[model samples]
Target: MNTSLSLLADLLKTAQKEGADRADILFIQTQSVSYQIRNGKMEETESSEQNEIGLRVFLGKKSAIISTTELKPDEFPRLASQALAMAKVLPEDKFSDLLEASSPQRLSKNLELFDPTLPTNDNILAYITEMEEQALAQKGITNSNGSSAAYGKSHIILLTSNGFKGEYQHSSFSAGISVVAGQGPTMQRDYATHTTTFYRDLDTAKSLGLQAAQRALARLNPKKPRTANLPIVFDPRIAGSLLGHFASAIKGNAIARGTSFLKQALGRTIFPKEVTIMDDPTCKKGLRSRPFDAEGVKAAPLTLVEEGTLQHWLLDIRSANQLNLPTNGRASRSPSSPPTPTHTNLYFKNGSHSRTDLMADIKEGIYITEMMGSAINGLTGDYSRGASGFMIRNGQLAEPVAEFTIAGNLNDMFANIGLANDLEFRYGVNSPTLRVHSMTVAGA
Candidate 1:
């Protein structure tokens, strides 16, 4: 065991003996490595470190939390006193509960979160530089793109008064390239991706660069758009964004505060029957996988929406207490801010339609490739957004298009949206190629 961990555990035990009905302590340690290449040269390479801990105490109906970077015995009592004082002044909260429940039984394994033999910044830069050189080889590519790669590792532990103690560690890495093609009025740009929990999962630099160049060249001929209520096909990347939209709708905090559209829609069919949404924090190799969440609550897979029917809303300790339900282990805390809600590896299940097959069904609809601007009301479910992509002609991808607005009420979009079998788990929230019918398309 790490020496610091033992000392912290002792500190927590001491806090429990100091007249508090319930208490919890969290310890966080993190490190990051980042490399940036500019103009075919290594521009930046750096690392960061973070070490902090937080403590929460409960007294009767009131509760408060305090955190510090200092890890001394004299500071603990002062921090506790400050929290107790603050708890005395705040109004009684309905969601404040001292949880004494046991955790779910889960198959546990030690996940490998560190690779000491991973390439260093200099070696990684050499690879990125080589990639840019390859991208510039494309005939129409006017300017080669630089690449940025980052790796991060975080370790966290949680100890609660009710006999729950847990810890988890994880790692993440991402690489991206931006390419410019053509010249003057024909100038256009495109990008490509490579990201994973392990270094081995990334694509080679040459492949990544070529993909970026090919994507940019595909947008050569711009097409004009028109105002029509037609089916819009969302590529896998854009489709995944719907998960965030759903996350907002089912946040217990949002519902309790009367700020969520789904607040009054529990047990109702919120999305199509084929659209099943899950919050999985233990997905193998998932970037957000963990045994626990930011607040140290045990993490388990949750079905937020299943088979079109509303199921569960995300909950933190506070919100769960108020609802008299188990916490979902989804909360975040910063040095200056209190605990708040977040998601981990929220995924939408795949259907039975591929991207090519799905697009072939759209005769004259828009294929949204990129989304811009935010125009969704979290509380009302009203949605409108600026989009850029391509237009479909005769069931085939036709001319490139840009600067269009797609407007629809999310409450309606949910019920009418169709899922494609092209589901991909690229980033955090992943969905497949999605088709939404009869959205108001504003184009000239």
Candidate 2:
């Protein structure tokens, strides 16, 4: 058994012995390896490993959480006693509940997660080299910001007093390029990347580099968009960003705590009938798919919003306890914490209109190729972001533009947004070209 697993079992046993009513133990370990290439040469290659264990114990309705990276045998008992002592002094709560349904039901796991002794560092570097060379070959391209690849093999274990115990290992990779394009007195730079759990699914380094090159080159002749309140088209990447805002409103934790901007708006026509959003943790070969969440509960497909009505909120053990709902396995943890409500593979369902047809009648509008800055407010759903892209004049991409701002409120945006058929799930979250009827487009 893994050291972390053994530590979790020992920690839980000791916690129970120390007079806790109930408790759960969470163990985590991660191995991260990375390779970076700069200016056509390998800049750095490195790896790191770490491990930790967290204990959550309940004394009456009060619970306390404690963690440690040290695995010494004596530390377990001391940590348990210390946690109980703290819990005893804390106030009781209505939402406090010990882990239950800790045992997971048998189900299919994400097969794409991990494999031992993956292709050596040499294999990854070779591919990165190819991508860099491809970008340098592009005309008007001079030097590069860099090309890089990263991989992580992470393992986690969960154990609870209610007889639930499970562990899983996840493998992931990220690759991309940053290129600089130059013309006589002008230079522009940009980057693009793809992250996946499987190595084979990544785009060729050359393809990745070329795309970055194209992005940089497109800015060479950016022109101002014709000022107007016309409809706009958002590529899938940008569309997905807008959809992400919806997740915050659907989070049960957020809604119950009165922190969400979407509170009390349930049961009403919140969005257009064509707009539907769902989260599927079991998406086959999906980058964000997982067999089980950070909490040891059953996970299945869930529609956050169906058509125009709110469906359900994202929940974890903590939030579920407050709402008196069943465990939805929506929990996830980083290297330093325990399970919390997080998404699996959340995305908007693709629509049926093609990009050309979607933009057919629009005489003049902007096609936002990229958005800059984090200007969306989670509480109010209001959004304002710096942007740069191309102008659609008479239904054709006429000129590139930059140094502008786009602003809108999410409520109004979703109620009137239109989705094109071109939506593709390039990531776990995706949407087609979306057209927000009218937004304030601040010009250069």
Candidate 3:
């Protein structure tokens, strides 16, 4: 047994002896290092290590949760007794209970989630310096915001009185660069970043730096368009936000509270027939992949949307009980919080058309590369946000544009979505280039 599992097992026994019907515990440890460089000099370096434990006790229909950073063996009895006392006073929550015990299946296939080789501080510093040097070497690049590299590892152990015991460890590495282009008042800034579970899978520092420089140079001088309704194409970098909104609307808690725009759309067609969205937790080396969810349920792929129709709501035990549905293993939790529904490795299926083909038919359109602000109403599906990107004219990308707002209801936008074949899994929530037939663009 893992050290954390042994500790949690002992704690659960103490809770039961203290008048708790059931209990579950989580233990986590994380270590990280980050280094940053700016203007040919090291700007900052940081290192952190943390260990936390959380305990949840249930007495029939009531439950209470508590977390602590103190892990002394003598403190376990006090912590368990405290949780039991809190549960006794809390109002009954009929939806709370431990998951039923079953033979827990360990991951048979290698997920490639961890890399044991830890990068030294010198290695990280070298990466940041190379990235900064490459970005500064670009002709139009004038200044740099900074370049950075980070590496981290996390270990988790979950135990329940119902007989579930599991442990996993994963590591992550990332590199990024941000640069300014042009001079003085006309300067524009852009950045590029990449992260991976395996250090070897990270993109080259030079590639990331050059990409940032080119993007910044492209936005040296931007124009504002006349206010009008136009075809809006979302670059792959920003297209994932659309999917994020969709996921939020389909969360089980949102559905139970009638707070989601998608509350009444279950089993109905909510998008074009060609659109399909999926949440997969089993992809090899996926950034968010795990053998099981936070609640001890086996993690599996789920089709949230299939052929334009809503399929299933993301759910955890509590939210599922609220809706009279089964848990779908979408539960995610931190040491200090209870499990909640969250998507892992979510993405839209790639479309058959290339990006050029998707935009070729539009005589005039906006290609959004970035977005800011949050003016979305989840209950009504109304979407509005500040945006910046380039203009598409005569089937080609034109000069950059900024200082604009794009507005539309998500329902209307989903119905008109046109997808392109440029999907990449660089982000956990990923999407291909997408085009919406028409939307209101407010600009000068």
Candidate 4:
């Protein structure tokens, strides 16, 4: 065992000896470097490193969590005693308990989660400079907002009083550019960025800069259309927001607390028969992949929605116990926080129709590429948001539109959703182009 793992194991043992029935320890060390450039000059540079340890102690049905940056052997006894003292006075929570004793699954050697190669700080700065230059070279791109490149890696270790013990490491690389187009009152801004587990998989700086410039230029002189009810198509970039909303609504805590719009939606046809959604934590090189949950439960794929019916709620041990359901291995946590349910690499299944085909039948509508602000009622699913994109007229993209509000109930929106075949796994939450039959577009 490595030094950190050995230390964490000893910490758990100390907690148990200090009047605790069960205990768990989590350790995380992270290192990151980032560079930012604007107007062909380096504006900011940053490097960070941190290590933290969290201890959780259980005394019968009462448990308490504590964390610190101190990781010395002599500190273990004090940490254990402090945590147990807190647990002793806390009110008993029947649902809060460790998983039954079981061996944690070994992490796969071929997870492809870490990249050993590290780019020099000079290389990162060069990339940022090139990104900014490319954006400024484009026609009508007047000013650069900024360009940035970053790399980060994290090492994680977990140990419990039971048989569970595991560790893993993951790395990330990302580059992005944001620029303004036009000048004065008509200026518009847009950005493009890509992040990947391996440095080689990131999009080239030139490609990202050019994409940013084109998006900004396309939005120059945008107009607000007349108010009306019309079909609304969502570009892949913004369509994922719908899936995010769905994920939030189906979290186990939301369901158990009666706060979710889909609280009573399980096993019901809430969408079209063709719609399906999945949360997969085992995808190789996935941005959010994990070998096990924070509670040491083995990770597995889950079908959240199947053939229009709600199939499962993402859950951790506590929420699952409250609902009298088994956990789906979706628990996530930080060193200082307790476990909570969250999805990993969530995506909707692709549909047979092309994006063009989905918008071809619309006489007049909007295609949303960006959305800002939200006014969603989680309990009632009433959704309203500010939107910007292009007007769709005669089966083709027309002039750009902005400063509009779209309003509808999420339940109604889910029922009317139409998926397109352009799905891509570019983000943790992925989706294809989506079309809603009709909505109130509050434009001037």
Q: Candidate 4's residue-wise lDDT over 156-239, tens digit each?
A: 888888888878898999998899999999999999999999999999888998999999999999999789998999999889
Question: TM per model?
Answer: 0.93, 0.94, 0.98, 0.98
Point out where model 3 deviates above 4 Å. Answer: 106-109
How large is the C-alpha RMSD of every model relative to the true structure? 2.3, 2.1, 1.1, 1.0
How well is each residue in 1-444 modelled by candidate 1, as lDDT tens digits?
A: 277677677667666666567777778788888887866877788889988877777787777777877678767667777777777787776566544556644634544544444577677887788777777789898885567778887777777777667776777777778888898887778888877878888788888888888888877766659988988888887887777898887777887788887888888998888888888877777877777665666668888888999888788877777666777788766643556677888877887777777778677998888889999988788889998888887678888898789998888888888887766677888888888877999988
| Angstrom error at residue 261, model 3 | 0.6
Considering every candidate listed, which one attains the maximal lDDT?
4
lDDT of every predicted structure (CA atoms): 0.77, 0.79, 0.90, 0.90
Query: Can you give the lDDT of residue 384 in candidate 1?
Result: 91
Per TM-score, what order, best first?
A: 4, 3, 2, 1
> Worst 10-residue stretch by lDDT in candidate 3?
103-112
- Runs with alpha carbons beyond 4 Å of true place in candidate 4: 103-106
| Pairs in clash, predicted candidate 3 | none
Candidate 4 lDDT (Cα, 0 to 1): 0.90
lDDT tens string, model 3, 186-207?
Answer: 8899999999999999999899
> lDDT value for candidate 3?
0.90
Which residue pairs of candidate 4 clash? none
